[model samples]
Target: MAALQIRQDYSAPDLRQRAARERDTRASLRLLAIANALEGMPRAEAAGLAGIKCQALHDAIQRFNAEGPDGLHDRHRSGRPEQLSPGQQAALKAHILHGPEPERDGVSAWHLVDLCEYVERTYGDSEWGLSGPLKRLNLSRQKTRPSHSNGHPAAQAAFKKGAAVTAAEPRGTAS
Candidate 1:
């Protein structure tokens, strides 16, 4: 197969300058590879100098030919789509912020597992995990310590006061 030609009008020095100015490391490497190629360096040597494969240099050459220096930069990639719609996400966020109802949700506070189950039951999204969604909604996993239902606040305060008084009392010295 014939080697792909770099149609961009930049000289070896001009390409090096562009590489120097490029903020993206990958793009700069591509630029350097093209510059070395323009300077009559072997394809393997050029790619090695740029720390990329010969095939990568070939691809870069094709991109340079088609779209000039701008094409050397990586294109924006749209990753995996969200499982829930914007409205559903908003509803989930609101539900989290409002907190769980003890009588209805069967819990005093919202836990990650409970929230995951809630999403599965309410939103019919069994695959959804609460961790990432909660993070995106600015919700943290921290919860206040649980208090015992039968604990007496007054008695506890009295006990603390008695302990403090006993601790402060001085002992008699032995003669």
Candidate 2:
């Protein structure tokens, strides 16, 4: 909407500096749109240039002309930008990989929380403020083998098949 045609007709962004800024921009745009209309520019041309359709532009112009300068706001620029940027998480993985180990001793397995804290500490300690988008690690802990364990992939597969299939058929159904 143009810079001036603001109203109390509908809900609006909060009435602080940001809201006031929105009003000014809207009021200014409203003025410009009306000026353009008055100068005989076509509605489509003016509206498109103002980043809205002619109908929207006309509506904005009407609202401003009737009211004052509070209507031009694009609300909710807060709260994590209010939308997701996909694959932003990749950057975090790269950063986490680059940072120092969280544990002084490299002997122990890493807990998930330890990794997270490590990320915060290592990067946050440095200048960049150390944040990146988050994602699950591609790898996971392999199931620990029992004390009497067989270390074969095929054995594992057979075990799974047996476990899965045994429940379905009773003890003597093969005949």
Candidate 3:
């Protein structure tokens, strides 16, 4: 197979330096390394230097030639679309800010399941979970700390005030 000629616009050392300074993803660095190796070496050797297969080296070269340095970076991909519209999101945020009341909403606190039901009933059918909405709204659920069942509030306050309370068995007797 005929060896593909690499463009001589930049030297291998220059490419290597640029690759070192590249702040993007690791794939870009690998592409730069491959481009540098291809400057003088054969496809197989260049691929080895870049720790990629020959096919990948060929693809990288084509990308580099067509789009220059920018082509070496990762391509943007569109992920799953959001279920809630802008207005719906705004409404949800407003509802969350209003908070829940025991007499009105019939709950002391808003739970994930309760929020999910509320969204489904109020906004429409939404598969969106609580976590995503909570993150987007920058809201967090308040949690209550566990307290001892037998703890006495008045006795605790007295202890804090330096009240001298004697032990049940007294300090001197072991029995």
Candidate 4:
């Protein structure tokens, strides 16, 4: 069987320059390295210099031959689709930003679990997890103790005075 060879080949220096300039991805560089090697060396040696398997080099060479530099790019992978659409995500963000109504939202503040449940009920995508949806909505967990409408300023001052006294007291039989 004949070894695969690069066609419409650029010179080694040209390939190097093109590889670096065409795209900045690792895949592109690797492809360019293989192409560069094939310019002056054999297929197996080219693959070795590129640190890829011969089969991979062959495939890349085929792609390069067919589509030039563009074929060397990483192909798009069909990842999991968004559980919520753009409008739905916007609505969710607004819902969070508007703040949860204690009586209406059934909770004082947003909890991830509660948010997940809300998403399930509101958007019908129960698969929505904490991090992904929160990131998508540009939301983060804010740690804040709820302030009471009738919080006692006097009591707080008294507590601070007592704390200062305690802190000032000599420890372990002074001097």
Error of 2 at 2 (Å): 15
Write the residue-wise lDDT of candidate 1 on 23-141 in tens digits. 99999999999999998898999999999999999999999988899999999899878888889989989998899999999988888889888989997898456688678878888
Report the Cα lDDT for candidate 4: 0.74
Per-model CA lDDT versus the true structure: 0.88, 0.49, 0.73, 0.74
lDDT of 2 by residue, 1-175 (tens): 5443434433322323233354366555555555455455677776665556676776766665565445443445555431223343455456445543536724244445555555455545222222222323353434245544557876677878446554566787895
Q: List the residue pairs that clash in candidate 1.
A: none
Per-candidate TM vs. native? 0.75, 0.30, 0.64, 0.65
In lDDT terms, how accurate is model 3? 0.73
Ordered from best to worst TM-score, the candidate numbers read 1, 4, 3, 2
Q: Is 3 or 4 the stronger prediction by lDDT?
A: 4
- Which candidate comes out best when scored by lDDT? 1
Cα RMSD of all models vs. native, in order, equals 5.4, 13.7, 5.5, 5.2
**Per-residue lDDT of 1-175 in model 4, one digit per residue for the tens?**
8766666556666667777686556565666666656666777777777777777777887877788766777788998888888898888889988888999889988888888888888877885466776776678787677778998998778777445554556777775
Least well predicted 10-residue stretch by lDDT in candidate 3:
25-34
